[model samples]
Target: MKTIYVTAIFIFMAVTVFAQGGPPATPIDGGLSFLLAAGGAYGAKKLMDRRKNK
Candidate 1:
């Protein structure tokens, strides 16, 4: 148990110490827009199918 705790602490410290790099930029415009459009189309299709059934 003590060794596990020590290892965890060491790993966390090493990660923090080594993670001082540059910027982390994630471009989410195109993929996010496509995802939103697909979700909207799926929801609209489901709603239409349900309404047609009733």
Candidate 2:
């Protein structure tokens, strides 16, 4: 348990020492639209299936 705690502390310190930040960039707009369309189609199909079974 003591070794685990020591190892974790060392890793945290190393990450903090080397960490750096950069400027943000533009985000893609197509992937999310495609996912939303696919999900809607899937949900519609499931709803239709359930209604047909009733």
Cα RMSD of all models vs. native, in order, equals 9.3, 10.5
What is the alpha-carbon lDDT of model 2 when measured against the actual structure? 0.92
Model 2 deviation from native, Cα RMSD in Å:
10.5
Query: Model 2 misses residue 38 by how many Å?
Result: 0.2
Tens-digit lDDT track for model 2 on 1-54? 999999999999999877856668767678888999999999999999999999
Query: TM-score for every candidate vs. truth?
Result: 0.57, 0.52
Per-residue lDDT tens digits for candidate 1, residues 1-54, read: 999999999999999989888778989999999999999999999999999999
Q: Output the number of the TM-score-best candidate.
A: 1
Point to the candidate with the largest lDDT: 1
